[model samples]
Target chain A: MTTLSLGAARAGVELRSFWRERDAVVFTFALPAVLLTLLGSLFSGVYEGSTVTSAQYLVPSMIAAGVASTTFVNLGIGIATDRDNGTLKRLRGLPMPPLAYLMGKVLLVLAVTFAEVLLLLAIGMVLFDLPLPASAARWLTLGWVFALGVVACSLMGVAASALPRSARSAAAVLNLPYVVLGFISGIYYTPIGALPDWVIQLGSVFPLKWMAQGFRSAFLPDTVLPQEVVPSWEHGRTALVLAAWCIGGLVLCLMTFGRRSRQTS
Target chain B: MTDHAVRVRGLRKSYRDTVAVDGLDLDIAVGEVRALLGPNGAGKTTTVEILEGHRSRDGGSVSVLGVDPARGGSSWRREIGIVLQATDDAGELTVAEMIRHVARYFPRPRGLDETLSLVGLESKRDSRIRRLSGGQRRRLDVALGIVGRPRLLFLDEPTTGFDPEARRQFWSTVRALDTTVLLTTHYLDEAEALADQVTVIAGGRVVAEGAPDTLGSRDVATVSWRDGREQTDDPAAVVARLTAAYGGPVPGLSVTRPSLEDVYLDLIGVPR
Candidate 1:
């Protein structure tokens, strides 16, 4: 009972702080939506030898891109800054469960990711002629794919925060790789199959690519499957790969959170 | 001694190869404001962190609230509060929001409004922590620490950098609190004003320990008058001589003792 109340209160604070920071909210939410709209229109034409319009192909990937950019940079930098400022130290000094603190931040991540996803989807459907999931099964698949992406990507952020020297550099240090991976994964304007084999293989190693694939499986019609690196939806492989990242990312988050929590320096 | 809030014996800690704390001991009685006085790098923070269970010690028998801090868990954590040395920056949390959030941690926390007013942040309740002055943030630190109504509160250098007015304001807030507080500070004057007992730790050992007024050896009293001044080892004798010379109580008479800083320098063998 204590844990629930404290956890709820902390999540409330994180949510409040998330939206209250105008620059961060605008950058995290608006940038992705704007990027999706801009890219979706600029490349409205279909790719070579494929009937799928760029709008349908890019929309699903951009949804994953939104979750990735927001969680990877936002959660990573948030944790690093908390450590640098002694806010984590202060929280460590409390009787509150550390998991409660983490749960609150995770809840905030999901909330922000939801808003980012909604804005992107709305823009995709309204502005770029992207279709909504038409069946109960399709909606369910989208729901779970989003859930998997959020958990895996956000935990990946927690692990990556260990890379930054301090809070000030966290954004630069953590965001660069996400930017590079986003570009390579065709989150911007690159087509997946159009990229060189090595670049596609490198993208495959990250959860971002798999997340895009999973979303594509749910959102894109069967006729458009050839554009993916797999040339088939590979739904089982998508779920397995994303789930593996979730479990592996969970282990990394625990390790990083534990080591970081014990830090007094 | 049995009712002591803290007891330590042969407390030792070494970081990498450098000795941070070497064989330190301390005993703080219940409800006493015990001040750990030392300069920077004097192992003050390390010693306090060990007691607060934030850091581990290499060799020591420690008891805080009757449980070894290393083994102490959440139940143990509930009995103590900590005011971390200010490192600045708490994001955009407002004064009230910060207090209210931390207040939810403890089993039975002090009232949010009560803690806010106690720290004299009533007017600044809506102000974000970034907008607050340094002293105001320190007060917020204290408010969060004591919101749990802890039996033992550890304040690690609560006022490291503060203007004279701000430091004085902070001292009053400390004085008004009802819990036993263990404050670490290098400022001798701060210790003199607030602590019921002062433990001077140097090179990770207790160099001196007693009430601030009685910690140093007896010394001469300095007397000043309108025209002249005198220092006599025996203040009573000086007073008698001055009274007799004036044929009554001395005129424009004033007495002075060495400030704690002076005594501290003497104890540490630093040339004044």
Candidate 2:
């Protein structure tokens, strides 16, 4: 069989293992949507001079965070667990190309992230009355942003997997930055304009901030534009930043992966 | 071109300041089951890992299946299967499912049913791997290892955690595989039971390499009679003389050669 086909088979196995862990599957799929519902209901007001409720504003922000959760956080913890449990070592010894193992993981994340995004969108539409993109241009923007965001975040996730010393500590190691990034990136607290300038600058240095901004542009209207930290959605810069992260993250992943002897064999 | 399944000379590896494998040499012919016997930290694992291509040796000329492991690519990897010690991954996958998942990596793989029976996991084919007992799980490990029908298999202390019964069962599973195997273990009886040739290493070097029974001194044998015991090269002659002197079967007469364990202890410089 071809290497790519082996990767596809590996993805099938990954998906099976992931889904069979019933609690993790439910929790992973439910966390962002649950938070959206609770936070959406708790923060009950429209932004000043705009009809878009705070809940509606949160929908897109949460979607971006949702993407990160599925790709970055999920992949990071999964890879670390694999490393700890001897999955990586076993795969390393196999005829499977190292690329195939990576491809399988990325494919798993892609599948899960799509499902996560759709779930969040469904909740936003039904519960918060958020509108889907009505324009082909908005849809196009959404596509590229989602694509680039997944690629960049997934690569970063693979790189980050090498940070945690073991599977037991992987959750804490990967999630701390994820939660902190959400706050500073305005996913947890929005109308990005409300945050301090330094916070905005710091948040902008990361991909989550740009991803949340891109999604906000796709979901929110021109009326909410001034509420953003920037007056307009910096589409070009968003693309540039996410693309740059993709390259940088790829390099980091290459540097860190296949390294020997962190865990006792 | 060589028919040896593995060949190594001066294989060395160190962890920072600690030398793990220092100038180790190994040779195993095709279809031979060679056991590497050593104490902990004697570089057995380091040597095996280097040969498996999972580790890089600091210095060595190593070839596995006619390819240098450090440079071994996917095709080279296909010819070898590895069962690592204490692998706890893929718990959520079922016995058959896990085997099938790995089988796809090889260009040609054993049939699912055939592989399952080979490792004696057919009864647990649909059971989750996590639910398997230790012995059964180990069988599954072997199932995954040999599913590709590799020409060479590396079993790194394959029966380390097994109970006596489980170890016996696992030995049979391994014995069923018609492939060259390089196993690492500290168990003398396990080495004697499974290995066609045993190589004992200490301090990262081969201390002795030969058939298990004759590893240390093939010439010496011990003869014990009711009246006396003596160590001599000609035990048959000693036994005959004792029987003739007694004018019947010599009372309490027993002839013994050095056991593999005795030889192993002597080889490793452990007094008994």
Candidate 3:
């Protein structure tokens, strides 16, 4: 339908707006890389007899970290600011298709997430000589994880857009969850499975844990970690958990968006 | 001529315990510019929002271009243009890019260059929205609104914060548009200049509706001269008599009807 195309076009516009901002692009891409390097260097020798380079472990974690930073923190704050500045109100008045507006945001988040993934993967390959997945299937699994991670994180960002009363407060609140999730899910350290039993269990309940797990399956070989813990890259569970997160996040975002629209109306 | 751009009867909306628009009725014909003049919180913006299909009314029979705006589809939205009070300025997109991007939403949109020229921003098309002056940004808002070639345009205080020269330029732009325009503003001068018919709303109801010159309908005219002023029912007779008494054309003399602002302020009641 023409309406659908228009909607997609609008989403394209939103995506372009994000890409045009140098500071936002730098923060989204560079910050995660910088943090990965710092954490990798700091924890280079924490575990004995561990063949995994800190950068190797950190690369996979940064995929999850990238989503949290870009999709959740960056997007959540940007949307809240849009709402506060009457941008949303203005858009609502246009001849724009409703789906187009939302699709634009989704496209933007997806593009940024993809870019982050690629950048992190490049850093791993060149700087740390991280091994490529041995087979096409392994690479396919990695792509699914990254794609689903983006969806889950973007949904969380949309839901979080409703929490803050202003742009400044929204940025602060969005950052807290991202930092907490990054630390808990092992984006800057070893997998949560290596932590205490309760910590791993708690982390598993969140999307970050499964996201990191999925990324780890792609980058690390079967010989690297305990078989029982890594489980030889279970594609089924990775797809299911990440899909569930995407759906749950979308539902929450829709509910919050509807509520906010009604309240403001 | 048969199509009414906007038609509403008994429109009502409430916010919690407060009633914002109560039993308001309006009928705007095609190609007519109607100004809704009122004090702040007189339900002008609320009424406009309802007509724009952005808000729901508690009770009403309302039609915009023969469709209930509350349930109007995307096709209906394409026919309406809304110039909001503010818009997104944080994006680094150039003015031309922003206009062209938004223009794609409509089935038939004005040319980008033409729209920019109409709003007097042709030279600044390459400038980022954030880099624009306040007046230039306001012009950009107008450019976006008209870019879609909407059949009906809703302008909510479009000239607020504009300098006098820019305001005059804006007035010309409004005059040039053939579409029906429904404007809400506290500026009586703006209403007088741009509106073909004026409706004064006070306390959520239409207090007066007529041509700007005759709203109060007082036959009495005020005749002023260098010495003093007097109110008379017959200004022509008074002027004729004055000419005879002065032995020539009356010196420094003028006859004035009550301005729209005077009638509006009087109807709304001047602050104590």
Between candidates 2 and 3, the TM-score winner: 2
CAPRI class of candidate 2: medium
The residue ranges of model 3 lying beyond 4 angstroms of the native Cα positions read: A46-50, A191-201, A226-243, B1-3, B223-233, B242-256
How would you encode candidate 2's per-residue C-alpha lDDT over A108-200 as one tens digit per residue? 998999999999999999999999987999999999999999999999998998999888898889889998999999998867899999999
Q: Which stretches of candidate 1 lie over 4 Å from their true place?
A: A47-51, B218-233, B239-256
Q: After superposition, how far is residue B64 of candidate 2 from its true place, in Å?
A: 2.3
**Model 2 Cα lDDT, one tens digit per residue, B190-263:** 99899999999899999999887778885589999778899998988998888789988899989889888878
Which pairs clash in the backbone of model 2?
none
Per-prediction DockQ, in order?
A: 0.60, 0.72, 0.56
**Per-residue lDDT tens digits of candidate 3, residues B1-272?**
25788898998988898888888889899999999998888888889989999888899899999999999888898898889886655457889988987788788899998998888898998998889987888888888889999999999898888899989998998998889999988898998899988888777787888877667674469999877788998898888888888889777899998777778888888853
Query: TM-score: which is higher, 1 or 3?
Result: 1
Give the runs in model 2 whose Cα sits over 4 Å from its true position.
Answer: A23-27, A196-198, A258-265, B14-19, B58-60, B224-228, B233-236, B246-256
Backbone steric clashes in candidate 2, count: 0
Error of 1 at A255 (Å): 4.2
The superposed Cα distance between candidate 1 and the true structure at residue B181, in angstroms, equals 1.2
Model 2's TM-score against the true structure:
0.93
Q: Ranking by TM-score, best first?
A: 2, 1, 3
Model 3, docking class: medium
Say which prediction, candidate 2 or candidate 3, comes out ahead on DockQ. Answer: 2
Query: Interface root-mean-square deviation for each candidate?
Result: 1.8, 1.4, 2.2
